[model samples]
Target: MAWRKLDKMIRPASCRAGCWRCVYGCPYGAKWTARDFIIEACRDGAHLADRARVLRVLVENGRAAGVEVEVQGKVHAVRAPVVVLAAGGLGSPRLLHASGLGPRCSPFFSDPVVAVMGSVDDIDGGAEVPMAAGLSLHEEGIALADLTLPQPMYAAFAAQVGRVDRLFAHKRTLSMMVKIRDEIGGGVGPRWADKTLADSDRKKLAHGVGMAKAILREAGAHHIFKSWHFAAHPGGSVRIGEGVDADLQTSTPGLYVCDASVIPEPWGLPPTLTLLCLGKRLGSSLAATRRAEGAA
Candidate 1:
Protein backbone atom coordinates (compact mmCIF):
# COMPACT_ATOMS: atom_id res chain seq x y z
CA MET A 1 0.00 0.00 0.00
CA ALA A 2 1.16 3.52 -0.78
CA TRP A 3 0.21 6.70 1.01
CA ARG A 4 0.08 10.06 -0.75
CA LYS A 5 0.30 13.44 0.97
CA LEU A 6 0.02 17.05 -0.16
CA ASP A 7 2.46 18.29 2.46
CA LYS A 8 4.33 20.36 -0.10
CA MET A 9 1.22 22.31 -1.04
CA ILE A 10 -0.81 22.19 2.20
CA ARG A 11 0.49 23.16 5.59
CA PRO A 12 -0.79 20.76 8.23
CA ALA A 13 -1.14 23.57 10.75
CA SER A 14 -3.50 25.45 8.46
CA CYS A 15 -6.01 22.61 8.19
CA ARG A 16 -9.13 23.16 10.30
CA ALA A 17 -11.28 20.37 11.72
CA GLY A 18 -14.57 19.84 9.87
CA CYS A 19 -13.44 22.36 7.29
CA TRP A 20 -13.64 20.62 3.92
CA ARG A 21 -12.75 23.63 1.85
CA CYS A 22 -10.37 21.35 0.01
CA VAL A 23 -13.37 19.51 -1.46
CA TYR A 24 -14.89 22.72 -2.71
CA GLY A 25 -12.56 25.71 -3.00
CA CYS A 26 -9.58 26.31 -0.76
CA PRO A 27 -9.35 29.88 0.47
CA TYR A 28 -5.81 29.37 1.76
CA GLY A 29 -4.39 28.77 -1.73
CA ALA A 30 -2.90 25.61 -0.30
CA LYS A 31 -4.47 23.59 -3.09
CA TRP A 32 -2.88 24.05 -6.47
CA THR A 33 -5.48 24.28 -9.24
CA ALA A 34 -5.61 25.09 -12.94
CA ARG A 35 -6.18 28.73 -11.92
CA ASP A 36 -2.61 28.86 -10.66
CA PHE A 37 -1.30 27.83 -14.08
CA ILE A 38 -3.64 30.29 -15.76
CA ILE A 39 -2.26 33.11 -13.62
CA GLU A 40 1.29 32.13 -14.53
CA ALA A 41 0.43 32.00 -18.22
CA CYS A 42 -1.23 35.41 -18.08
CA ARG A 43 1.80 36.85 -16.35
CA ASP A 44 3.97 35.41 -19.13
CA GLY A 45 2.09 37.28 -21.89
CA ALA A 46 -0.61 34.75 -22.64
CA HIS A 47 -4.02 36.22 -23.40
CA LEU A 48 -6.98 34.76 -21.52
CA ALA A 49 -10.52 35.45 -22.73
CA ASP A 50 -12.47 34.98 -19.56
CA ARG A 51 -16.05 33.71 -19.94
CA ALA A 52 -15.36 32.83 -23.57
CA ARG A 53 -16.81 29.69 -25.17
CA VAL A 54 -15.13 28.17 -28.19
CA LEU A 55 -17.73 27.60 -30.89
CA ARG A 56 -15.57 25.66 -33.30
CA VAL A 57 -12.09 25.28 -34.74
CA LEU A 58 -11.64 26.85 -38.16
CA VAL A 59 -9.85 24.67 -40.65
CA GLU A 60 -8.70 25.99 -44.05
CA ASN A 61 -6.74 24.19 -46.77
CA GLY A 62 -6.15 21.12 -44.54
CA ARG A 63 -4.78 23.20 -41.66
CA ALA A 64 -6.07 24.87 -38.52
CA ALA A 65 -6.62 28.61 -38.97
CA GLY A 66 -8.02 29.54 -35.55
CA VAL A 67 -11.23 29.31 -33.57
CA GLU A 68 -14.59 31.03 -33.35
CA VAL A 69 -15.46 32.01 -29.78
CA GLU A 70 -18.54 33.40 -28.10
CA VAL A 71 -18.02 35.88 -25.29
CA GLN A 72 -20.74 37.92 -23.58
CA GLY A 73 -23.21 37.11 -26.39
CA LYS A 74 -20.72 38.38 -29.02
CA VAL A 75 -18.97 36.07 -31.47
CA HIS A 76 -15.49 36.67 -32.87
CA ALA A 77 -12.67 34.82 -34.56
CA VAL A 78 -9.18 34.49 -33.11
CA ARG A 79 -6.56 33.49 -35.69
CA ALA A 80 -3.51 31.47 -34.80
CA PRO A 81 -0.94 29.27 -36.56
CA VAL A 82 -1.33 26.55 -33.92
CA VAL A 83 -4.46 25.52 -32.06
CA VAL A 84 -4.20 23.28 -29.03
CA LEU A 85 -7.34 21.62 -27.68
CA ALA A 86 -7.18 21.05 -23.94
CA ALA A 87 -10.87 21.19 -23.18
CA GLY A 88 -10.72 17.80 -21.44
CA GLY A 89 -12.05 14.36 -22.39
CA LEU A 90 -15.75 15.15 -22.65
CA GLY A 91 -15.50 18.70 -23.94
CA SER A 92 -12.73 17.94 -26.41
CA PRO A 93 -14.73 15.26 -28.18
CA ARG A 94 -17.70 17.58 -28.35
CA LEU A 95 -15.54 20.32 -29.84
CA LEU A 96 -14.04 17.95 -32.40
CA HIS A 97 -17.45 16.83 -33.53
CA ALA A 98 -18.62 20.44 -33.80
CA SER A 99 -15.52 21.31 -35.82
CA GLY A 100 -16.35 18.46 -38.28
CA LEU A 101 -13.05 16.81 -37.45
CA GLY A 102 -14.55 13.57 -36.12
CA PRO A 103 -18.01 12.15 -36.53
CA ARG A 104 -18.04 11.02 -32.90
CA CYS A 105 -15.73 9.79 -30.17
CA SER A 106 -15.27 6.03 -29.81
CA PRO A 107 -15.85 4.04 -26.64
CA PHE A 108 -14.51 5.65 -23.45
CA PHE A 109 -13.87 4.84 -19.80
CA SER A 110 -15.05 6.56 -16.67
CA ASP A 111 -13.46 5.16 -13.53
CA PRO A 112 -16.42 3.98 -11.48
CA VAL A 113 -16.10 4.25 -7.74
CA VAL A 114 -18.07 3.12 -4.69
CA ALA A 115 -17.34 3.91 -1.09
CA VAL A 116 -17.64 1.23 1.58
CA MET A 117 -18.45 2.64 4.96
CA GLY A 118 -18.67 1.24 8.48
CA SER A 119 -19.01 2.58 11.98
CA VAL A 120 -16.01 2.72 14.27
CA ASP A 121 -15.98 3.32 18.01
CA ASP A 122 -12.84 5.45 17.83
CA ILE A 123 -11.03 7.70 15.34
CA ASP A 124 -12.84 10.50 13.55
CA GLY A 125 -12.27 9.53 9.92
CA GLY A 126 -14.19 12.48 8.48
CA ALA A 127 -11.48 14.86 9.72
CA GLU A 128 -8.75 13.10 7.74
CA VAL A 129 -7.69 13.67 4.17
CA PRO A 130 -9.41 11.49 1.60
CA MET A 131 -7.69 8.96 -0.65
CA ALA A 132 -4.58 9.21 1.52
CA ALA A 133 -3.57 5.56 1.18
CA GLY A 134 -4.30 2.96 -1.43
CA LEU A 135 -3.07 0.03 -3.44
CA SER A 136 -3.82 -1.14 -6.94
CA LEU A 137 -4.65 -4.70 -7.86
CA HIS A 138 -3.56 -4.33 -11.43
CA GLU A 139 -4.51 -7.79 -12.62
CA GLU A 140 -7.96 -7.49 -11.12
CA GLY A 141 -8.38 -3.96 -12.46
CA ILE A 142 -9.24 -2.66 -9.01
CA ALA A 143 -7.90 0.00 -6.65
CA LEU A 144 -8.71 0.51 -2.99
CA ALA A 145 -8.11 3.55 -0.86
CA ASP A 146 -9.00 5.26 2.35
CA LEU A 147 -11.69 7.83 1.58
CA THR A 148 -12.92 10.37 4.11
CA LEU A 149 -15.84 12.40 2.89
CA PRO A 150 -17.10 15.61 4.48
CA GLN A 151 -20.05 15.17 6.84
CA PRO A 152 -22.61 16.49 4.40
CA MET A 153 -21.26 14.44 1.54
CA TYR A 154 -21.15 11.40 3.76
CA ALA A 155 -24.75 11.96 4.79
CA ALA A 156 -25.75 12.25 1.16
CA PHE A 157 -24.05 8.98 0.32
CA ALA A 158 -25.58 7.27 3.30
CA ALA A 159 -28.97 8.51 2.26
CA GLN A 160 -28.35 7.28 -1.27
CA VAL A 161 -28.26 3.69 -0.03
CA GLY A 162 -31.30 4.20 2.28
CA ARG A 163 -28.97 4.21 5.25
CA VAL A 164 -30.39 7.37 6.77
CA ASP A 165 -29.89 5.92 10.22
CA ARG A 166 -26.16 5.89 9.65
CA LEU A 167 -26.09 9.52 8.51
CA PHE A 168 -25.42 10.85 11.98
CA ALA A 169 -22.49 8.49 12.44
CA HIS A 170 -20.30 10.42 10.03
CA LYS A 171 -17.81 11.38 12.72
CA ARG A 172 -17.32 7.75 13.74
CA THR A 173 -17.53 6.30 10.23
CA LEU A 174 -14.58 4.73 8.51
CA SER A 175 -14.69 4.80 4.74
CA MET A 176 -12.83 3.23 1.85
CA MET A 177 -13.31 3.54 -1.86
CA VAL A 178 -13.33 0.82 -4.51
CA LYS A 179 -12.50 2.11 -7.92
CA ILE A 180 -12.58 -0.18 -10.95
CA ARG A 181 -11.16 0.14 -14.41
CA ASP A 182 -14.41 -0.04 -16.30
CA GLU A 183 -14.59 -1.38 -19.82
CA ILE A 184 -14.54 1.20 -22.57
CA GLY A 185 -17.89 1.05 -24.35
CA GLY A 186 -19.49 4.48 -24.55
CA GLY A 187 -20.04 6.97 -27.34
CA VAL A 188 -19.61 10.73 -27.14
CA GLY A 189 -21.34 13.09 -29.51
CA PRO A 190 -21.17 16.82 -30.02
CA ARG A 191 -23.91 17.41 -27.49
CA TRP A 192 -24.03 14.27 -25.37
CA ALA A 193 -22.05 11.38 -23.86
CA ASP A 194 -23.07 8.15 -22.18
CA LYS A 195 -21.49 5.03 -20.64
CA THR A 196 -22.63 1.66 -19.31
CA LEU A 197 -20.66 -0.70 -17.14
CA ALA A 198 -19.81 -4.16 -18.45
CA ASP A 199 -20.47 -7.23 -16.38
CA SER A 200 -16.71 -7.62 -15.88
CA ASP A 201 -16.55 -4.16 -14.41
CA ARG A 202 -19.31 -4.92 -11.95
CA LYS A 203 -17.63 -8.17 -10.94
CA LYS A 204 -14.38 -6.35 -10.27
CA LEU A 205 -16.16 -3.77 -8.14
CA ALA A 206 -17.98 -6.49 -6.20
CA HIS A 207 -14.72 -8.26 -5.45
CA GLY A 208 -13.12 -5.05 -4.33
CA VAL A 209 -16.04 -4.26 -2.07
CA GLY A 210 -15.81 -7.69 -0.51
CA MET A 211 -12.13 -7.14 0.19
CA ALA A 212 -12.85 -3.72 1.67
CA LYS A 213 -15.50 -5.19 3.93
CA ALA A 214 -13.02 -7.76 5.17
CA ILE A 215 -10.49 -5.07 5.91
CA LEU A 216 -13.05 -2.94 7.75
CA ARG A 217 -14.08 -5.93 9.83
CA GLU A 218 -10.43 -6.49 10.75
CA ALA A 219 -10.31 -2.89 11.99
CA GLY A 220 -13.33 -3.52 14.24
CA ALA A 221 -15.80 -1.61 12.13
CA HIS A 222 -19.55 -2.46 12.27
CA HIS A 223 -22.76 -1.67 10.38
CA ILE A 224 -20.94 -1.92 7.10
CA PHE A 225 -22.58 -0.66 3.93
CA LYS A 226 -21.67 0.75 0.54
CA SER A 227 -22.51 3.81 -1.48
CA TRP A 228 -23.95 3.81 -4.97
CA HIS A 229 -21.54 3.73 -7.87
CA PHE A 230 -20.25 7.10 -9.00
CA ALA A 231 -17.84 7.99 -11.75
CA ALA A 232 -14.73 10.18 -11.80
CA HIS A 233 -12.06 11.08 -14.36
CA PRO A 234 -13.90 10.31 -17.60
CA GLY A 235 -11.50 9.90 -20.51
CA GLY A 236 -10.43 7.90 -23.60
CA SER A 237 -13.05 9.50 -25.81
CA VAL A 238 -10.68 11.09 -28.36
CA ARG A 239 -7.96 8.51 -28.21
CA ILE A 240 -4.42 8.74 -29.47
CA GLY A 241 -3.80 6.82 -32.74
CA GLU A 242 -7.52 6.86 -33.62
CA GLY A 243 -8.41 10.52 -33.14
CA VAL A 244 -4.91 12.02 -32.79
CA ASP A 245 -1.38 10.97 -33.59
CA ALA A 246 1.47 10.23 -31.20
CA ASP A 247 2.37 13.92 -31.25
CA LEU A 248 -1.25 14.60 -30.23
CA GLN A 249 -1.83 16.29 -33.58
CA THR A 250 -5.21 15.80 -35.20
CA SER A 251 -5.75 15.15 -38.93
CA THR A 252 -5.80 18.89 -39.50
CA PRO A 253 -2.25 20.27 -39.37
CA GLY A 254 -1.35 22.80 -36.64
CA LEU A 255 -4.20 21.49 -34.44
CA TYR A 256 -3.20 19.41 -31.44
CA VAL A 257 -4.82 17.97 -28.34
CA CYS A 258 -3.36 17.89 -24.83
CA ASP A 259 -5.85 16.52 -22.34
CA ALA A 260 -7.48 13.41 -20.95
CA SER A 261 -9.27 13.03 -24.28
CA VAL A 262 -6.04 11.77 -25.83
CA ILE A 263 -5.45 9.02 -23.31
CA PRO A 264 -5.73 5.83 -25.34
CA GLU A 265 -6.83 3.33 -22.73
CA PRO A 266 -8.81 2.69 -19.58
CA TRP A 267 -7.25 4.39 -16.57
CA GLY A 268 -8.41 3.53 -13.06
CA LEU A 269 -6.02 5.81 -11.18
CA PRO A 270 -5.61 9.55 -10.78
CA PRO A 271 -4.40 11.23 -13.99
CA THR A 272 -3.07 14.53 -12.65
CA LEU A 273 0.62 13.62 -13.06
CA THR A 274 0.10 11.97 -16.44
CA LEU A 275 -1.72 15.04 -17.73
CA LEU A 276 0.98 17.37 -16.38
CA CYS A 277 3.66 15.42 -18.21
CA LEU A 278 1.67 15.43 -21.45
CA GLY A 279 1.05 19.19 -21.18
CA LYS A 280 4.73 19.92 -20.52
CA ARG A 281 5.82 17.78 -23.42
CA LEU A 282 3.30 19.35 -25.78
CA GLY A 283 4.29 22.88 -24.72
CA SER A 284 7.97 22.13 -25.28
CA SER A 285 7.31 20.63 -28.68
CA LEU A 286 5.17 23.59 -29.77
CA ALA A 287 7.78 26.07 -28.51
CA ALA A 288 10.53 24.25 -30.42
CA THR A 289 8.42 24.23 -33.58
CA ARG A 290 7.81 27.96 -33.24
CA ARG A 291 11.55 28.64 -32.79
CA ALA A 292 12.36 26.61 -35.92
CA GLU A 293 9.83 28.58 -37.98
CA GLY A 294 11.21 31.86 -36.63
CA ALA A 295 14.76 30.86 -37.59
CA ALA A 296 13.63 29.71 -41.05
Candidate 2:
Protein backbone atom coordinates (compact mmCIF):
# COMPACT_ATOMS: atom_id res chain seq x y z
CA MET A 1 0.00 0.00 0.00
CA ALA A 2 2.94 2.32 0.49
CA TRP A 3 3.54 2.46 -3.24
CA ARG A 4 -0.16 3.19 -3.75
CA LYS A 5 0.05 6.20 -1.44
CA LEU A 6 3.39 7.42 -2.70
CA ASP A 7 1.82 10.38 -4.49
CA LYS A 8 -1.64 10.73 -2.94
CA MET A 9 -0.75 10.28 0.76
CA ILE A 10 -3.80 8.12 1.47
CA ARG A 11 -4.16 8.01 5.23
CA PRO A 12 -4.49 10.92 7.67
CA ALA A 13 -2.90 9.05 10.55
CA SER A 14 0.11 8.47 8.27
CA CYS A 15 0.81 12.17 7.53
CA ARG A 16 0.88 13.00 11.23
CA ALA A 17 3.74 10.58 11.78
CA GLY A 18 6.10 12.10 9.15
CA CYS A 19 6.67 8.66 7.62
CA TRP A 20 4.78 9.97 4.56
CA ARG A 21 4.36 7.96 1.34
CA CYS A 22 7.10 5.43 0.86
CA VAL A 23 6.59 1.91 -0.48
CA TYR A 24 8.43 -0.20 2.01
CA GLY A 25 6.40 -3.20 0.79
CA CYS A 26 9.52 -4.33 -0.97
CA PRO A 27 12.44 -2.27 0.31
CA TYR A 28 14.09 -3.03 -3.00
CA GLY A 29 12.37 -1.53 -6.02
CA ALA A 30 13.90 -4.19 -8.24
CA LYS A 31 11.08 -6.72 -8.12
CA TRP A 32 12.80 -8.65 -10.90
CA THR A 33 12.35 -12.35 -10.09
CA ALA A 34 12.66 -15.82 -11.65
CA ARG A 35 9.58 -15.19 -13.85
CA ASP A 36 11.50 -12.40 -15.60
CA PHE A 37 14.44 -14.71 -16.08
CA ILE A 38 12.25 -17.41 -17.66
CA ILE A 39 10.63 -14.90 -20.01
CA GLU A 40 14.06 -13.87 -21.23
CA ALA A 41 15.00 -17.50 -21.77
CA CYS A 42 11.80 -18.04 -23.77
CA ARG A 43 12.63 -14.95 -25.84
CA ASP A 44 16.07 -16.37 -26.53
CA GLY A 45 14.43 -19.62 -27.62
CA ALA A 46 12.04 -17.68 -29.90
CA HIS A 47 9.70 -20.17 -31.61
CA LEU A 48 10.41 -22.83 -28.98
CA ALA A 49 8.49 -21.45 -25.96
CA ASP A 50 5.11 -20.86 -27.60
CA ARG A 51 4.38 -18.74 -24.48
CA ALA A 52 2.04 -21.28 -22.88
CA ARG A 53 1.24 -22.31 -19.31
CA VAL A 54 0.95 -26.09 -19.12
CA LEU A 55 -2.31 -27.15 -17.47
CA ARG A 56 -1.82 -30.88 -17.84
CA VAL A 57 1.03 -33.11 -18.97
CA LEU A 58 -0.16 -35.31 -21.83
CA VAL A 59 1.34 -38.70 -20.96
CA GLU A 60 1.01 -41.61 -23.37
CA ASN A 61 2.47 -45.09 -22.79
CA GLY A 62 4.05 -43.58 -19.59
CA ARG A 63 6.88 -41.95 -21.61
CA ALA A 64 5.41 -38.44 -21.12
CA ALA A 65 5.02 -36.51 -24.36
CA GLY A 66 3.33 -33.18 -25.20
CA VAL A 67 1.06 -31.02 -22.97
CA GLU A 68 -2.16 -29.03 -22.69
CA VAL A 69 -1.84 -25.39 -21.65
CA GLU A 70 -4.07 -22.32 -21.34
CA VAL A 71 -3.38 -19.49 -23.73
CA GLN A 72 -5.29 -16.21 -23.30
CA GLY A 73 -7.90 -18.16 -21.30
CA LYS A 74 -8.17 -20.73 -24.05
CA VAL A 75 -6.84 -24.23 -23.47
CA HIS A 76 -4.55 -25.39 -26.28
CA ALA A 77 -2.91 -28.76 -26.72
CA VAL A 78 0.49 -29.24 -28.33
CA ARG A 79 2.22 -32.46 -29.21
CA ALA A 80 6.00 -32.15 -28.66
CA PRO A 81 6.88 -35.84 -28.04
CA VAL A 82 8.83 -34.35 -25.07
CA VAL A 83 7.62 -31.95 -22.41
CA VAL A 84 9.19 -29.87 -19.62
CA LEU A 85 7.48 -28.73 -16.41
CA ALA A 86 8.94 -25.61 -14.81
CA ALA A 87 5.81 -24.27 -13.17
CA GLY A 88 7.65 -23.40 -9.92
CA GLY A 89 6.62 -24.56 -6.40
CA LEU A 90 2.95 -23.74 -6.17
CA GLY A 91 1.67 -24.86 -9.53
CA SER A 92 3.89 -27.92 -9.98
CA PRO A 93 2.19 -30.00 -7.27
CA ARG A 94 -1.25 -29.13 -8.54
CA LEU A 95 -0.14 -30.11 -12.01
CA LEU A 96 0.99 -33.47 -10.70
CA HIS A 97 -2.35 -34.05 -8.96
CA ALA A 98 -4.36 -33.18 -12.06
CA SER A 99 -2.19 -35.52 -14.10
CA GLY A 100 -2.83 -38.43 -11.67
CA LEU A 101 0.93 -38.61 -11.15
CA GLY A 102 1.53 -37.46 -7.55
CA PRO A 103 -1.01 -37.61 -4.75
CA ARG A 104 1.33 -37.74 -1.74
CA CYS A 105 3.59 -35.11 -3.24
CA SER A 106 4.41 -32.84 -0.34
CA PRO A 107 3.29 -29.21 -0.63
CA PHE A 108 7.03 -28.41 -0.35
CA PHE A 109 6.59 -24.65 -0.45
CA SER A 110 8.65 -22.01 1.40
CA ASP A 111 8.22 -18.18 1.62
CA PRO A 112 9.09 -17.84 5.29
CA VAL A 113 10.37 -14.21 5.24
CA VAL A 114 10.66 -12.16 8.42
CA ALA A 115 9.44 -8.53 8.30
CA VAL A 116 11.01 -5.74 10.42
CA MET A 117 10.04 -2.12 11.00
CA GLY A 118 11.81 0.48 13.12
CA SER A 119 12.04 4.27 12.88
CA VAL A 120 15.09 5.82 11.21
CA ASP A 121 15.71 9.46 10.42
CA ASP A 122 17.64 8.35 7.34
CA ILE A 123 17.19 4.70 6.54
CA ASP A 124 20.62 3.50 5.45
CA GLY A 125 19.66 -0.13 4.93
CA GLY A 126 17.19 0.75 2.20
CA ALA A 127 19.98 2.31 0.13
CA GLU A 128 21.71 -1.02 -0.42
CA VAL A 129 21.71 -2.60 -3.89
CA PRO A 130 20.38 -5.96 -5.12
CA MET A 131 17.70 -5.26 -2.51
CA ALA A 132 19.32 -7.47 0.14
CA ALA A 133 23.08 -7.07 0.36
CA GLY A 134 23.92 -9.27 3.35
CA LEU A 135 22.34 -11.75 5.68
CA SER A 136 21.70 -11.12 9.36
CA LEU A 137 22.14 -14.86 9.78
CA HIS A 138 21.55 -18.17 7.95
CA GLU A 139 20.99 -21.88 8.35
CA GLU A 140 19.74 -24.69 6.08
CA GLY A 141 16.22 -23.23 6.16
CA ILE A 142 16.45 -19.66 7.50
CA ALA A 143 17.51 -16.35 5.89
CA LEU A 144 17.49 -12.82 7.26
CA ALA A 145 17.43 -9.52 5.33
CA ASP A 146 16.62 -5.81 5.59
CA LEU A 147 13.31 -6.14 3.69
CA THR A 148 12.55 -2.69 2.21
CA LEU A 149 8.91 -1.63 2.22
CA PRO A 150 7.60 1.75 1.05
CA GLN A 151 7.31 4.62 3.53
CA PRO A 152 3.55 5.02 3.16
CA MET A 153 2.89 1.59 4.70
CA TYR A 154 4.62 2.70 7.86
CA ALA A 155 1.94 5.16 8.96
CA ALA A 156 0.67 2.96 11.75
CA PHE A 157 4.22 2.02 12.71
CA ALA A 158 4.86 5.40 14.29
CA ALA A 159 1.89 4.97 16.62
CA GLN A 160 3.15 1.82 18.36
CA VAL A 161 2.78 4.30 21.24
CA GLY A 162 5.36 3.09 23.71
CA ARG A 163 9.16 2.94 23.56
CA VAL A 164 9.21 3.31 19.72
CA ASP A 165 9.74 7.11 19.79
CA ARG A 166 13.38 6.62 20.62
CA LEU A 167 13.91 4.70 17.39
CA PHE A 168 13.37 7.72 15.15
CA ALA A 169 15.44 9.76 17.57
CA HIS A 170 18.32 7.34 17.21
CA LYS A 171 17.94 7.18 13.40
CA ARG A 172 18.84 3.51 13.48
CA THR A 173 15.35 2.04 13.23
CA LEU A 174 15.08 0.13 9.95
CA SER A 175 13.47 -3.05 8.60
CA MET A 176 15.32 -6.34 8.78
CA MET A 177 14.20 -9.97 8.27
CA VAL A 178 14.94 -13.67 8.85
CA LYS A 179 13.45 -15.83 6.13
CA ILE A 180 12.83 -19.49 6.86
CA ARG A 181 14.43 -22.05 4.60
CA ASP A 182 12.51 -24.44 6.77
CA GLU A 183 12.20 -28.19 6.55
CA ILE A 184 9.14 -29.43 4.62
CA GLY A 185 6.83 -30.72 7.31
CA GLY A 186 3.71 -29.86 9.31
CA GLY A 187 1.56 -29.57 6.20
CA VAL A 188 0.12 -26.15 5.33
CA GLY A 189 -3.25 -25.06 6.68
CA PRO A 190 -6.32 -23.85 4.80
CA ARG A 191 -6.17 -20.89 2.37
CA TRP A 192 -2.69 -22.00 1.23
CA ALA A 193 -3.95 -22.57 -2.33
CA ASP A 194 -4.27 -18.80 -2.72
CA LYS A 195 -1.38 -17.29 -0.67
CA THR A 196 1.10 -20.18 -0.16
CA LEU A 197 1.38 -19.06 3.45
CA ALA A 198 0.93 -21.05 6.68
CA ASP A 199 -0.09 -20.22 10.23
CA SER A 200 2.38 -22.48 12.05
CA ASP A 201 5.13 -20.72 10.13
CA ARG A 202 4.68 -17.70 12.40
CA LYS A 203 6.41 -19.51 15.24
CA LYS A 204 9.51 -19.94 13.12
CA LEU A 205 9.42 -16.26 12.14
CA ALA A 206 9.34 -15.07 15.73
CA HIS A 207 12.99 -15.93 16.07
CA GLY A 208 13.89 -13.36 13.44
CA VAL A 209 11.55 -10.82 14.94
CA GLY A 210 13.36 -11.06 18.28
CA MET A 211 16.77 -10.86 16.66
CA ALA A 212 15.90 -7.93 14.35
CA LYS A 213 14.41 -5.97 17.23
CA ALA A 214 17.49 -6.61 19.34
CA ILE A 215 19.84 -5.57 16.54
CA LEU A 216 17.98 -2.29 16.04
CA ARG A 217 17.74 -1.65 19.76
CA GLU A 218 21.47 -2.20 20.03
CA ALA A 219 21.88 -0.03 16.94
CA GLY A 220 19.70 2.56 18.74
CA ALA A 221 16.20 1.87 17.31
CA HIS A 222 13.31 2.43 19.70
CA HIS A 223 9.57 2.86 19.37
CA ILE A 224 9.49 -0.08 16.99
CA PHE A 225 6.59 -2.19 15.75
CA LYS A 226 6.38 -5.73 17.06
CA SER A 227 4.87 -7.23 13.89
CA TRP A 228 6.70 -8.51 10.82
CA HIS A 229 5.87 -10.06 7.38
CA PHE A 230 7.37 -13.05 5.56
CA ALA A 231 6.97 -13.64 1.84
CA ALA A 232 8.69 -14.25 -1.51
CA HIS A 233 10.54 -17.46 -2.50
CA PRO A 234 7.87 -20.15 -2.28
CA GLY A 235 8.81 -23.60 -3.54
CA GLY A 236 9.92 -27.16 -2.61
CA SER A 237 7.05 -29.03 -4.18
CA VAL A 238 8.23 -31.47 -6.85
CA ARG A 239 11.47 -31.53 -4.92
CA ILE A 240 14.46 -33.30 -6.43
CA GLY A 241 15.19 -36.87 -5.24
CA GLU A 242 11.76 -36.91 -3.60
CA GLY A 243 9.10 -35.59 -5.96
CA VAL A 244 11.39 -35.03 -8.97
CA ASP A 245 14.81 -36.30 -10.03
CA ALA A 246 18.37 -34.92 -9.96
CA ASP A 247 17.93 -33.43 -13.44
CA LEU A 248 14.65 -31.86 -12.23
CA GLN A 249 12.84 -34.46 -14.33
CA THR A 250 9.85 -36.06 -12.69
CA SER A 251 9.22 -39.83 -12.62
CA THR A 252 7.41 -39.28 -15.89
CA PRO A 253 10.07 -39.36 -18.59
CA GLY A 254 10.77 -36.31 -20.77
CA LEU A 255 8.79 -34.17 -18.31
CA TYR A 256 11.07 -31.66 -16.61
CA VAL A 257 10.66 -28.71 -14.25
CA CYS A 258 13.23 -25.90 -14.14
CA ASP A 259 12.14 -23.32 -11.58
CA ALA A 260 12.03 -22.74 -7.83
CA SER A 261 9.24 -25.35 -7.84
CA VAL A 262 11.86 -28.06 -8.09
CA ILE A 263 13.84 -26.97 -5.05
CA PRO A 264 13.11 -29.31 -2.12
CA GLU A 265 14.05 -26.79 0.54
CA PRO A 266 14.63 -23.05 0.84
CA TRP A 267 18.26 -21.87 0.49
CA GLY A 268 17.77 -19.26 3.25
CA LEU A 269 19.03 -16.51 0.94
CA PRO A 270 18.43 -15.16 -2.57
CA PRO A 271 17.58 -18.31 -4.57
CA THR A 272 16.92 -16.60 -7.93
CA LEU A 273 20.63 -16.38 -8.62
CA THR A 274 21.08 -20.12 -8.23
CA LEU A 275 17.76 -20.96 -9.94
CA LEU A 276 18.85 -18.97 -13.02
CA CYS A 277 22.12 -20.85 -13.08
CA LEU A 278 20.22 -24.15 -13.02
CA GLY A 279 17.83 -23.00 -15.76
CA LYS A 280 20.82 -22.11 -17.91
CA ARG A 281 22.17 -25.62 -17.46
CA LEU A 282 18.79 -27.13 -18.33
CA GLY A 283 18.40 -24.97 -21.46
CA SER A 284 21.85 -25.91 -22.73
CA SER A 285 21.19 -29.59 -22.15
CA LEU A 286 17.86 -29.38 -23.99
CA ALA A 287 19.44 -27.46 -26.90
CA ALA A 288 22.25 -30.03 -27.18
CA THR A 289 19.76 -32.91 -27.45
CA ARG A 290 17.70 -31.04 -30.02
CA ARG A 291 20.82 -30.29 -32.07
CA ALA A 292 21.89 -33.96 -32.01
CA GLU A 293 18.40 -35.03 -33.10
CA GLY A 294 18.49 -32.58 -36.03
CA ALA A 295 21.89 -33.89 -37.16
CA ALA A 296 20.68 -37.49 -36.98
What would the TM-scores of all predictions be?
A: 0.92, 0.70
- TM-score of candidate 1 on Cα atoms, chains taken together: 0.92
Q: Which portions of model 1 show Cα errors greater than 4 Å?
A: 1-19
Q: Worst ten-residue run, lDDT, model 2?
A: 1-10
Clashes of 2: 27
RMSD, one per candidate, in order: 2.1, 8.8
In angstroms, the error of model 2 at 146 is 2.0
Name the lDDT of candidate 2. Answer: 0.59
For 1-296, candidate 1 gives per-residue lDDT tens digits of 44344222455676665665566756776566778888999999999999999999999899999999999999999999999998987888888889998776557888999999999998755776576678888878898888888888999999999998898999899999999998878777767777878888989999999999999999999999999898788889878998899999998999998899898988897887789989999999999988999999
| Model 2 CA deviation exceeding 4 Å by range | 1-45, 48-53, 121-130, 139-141, 152-173, 186-191, 194-204
**Residue 68 CA displacement from its true place in model 2, Å:** 1.3
lDDT of model 2 at position 217? 80
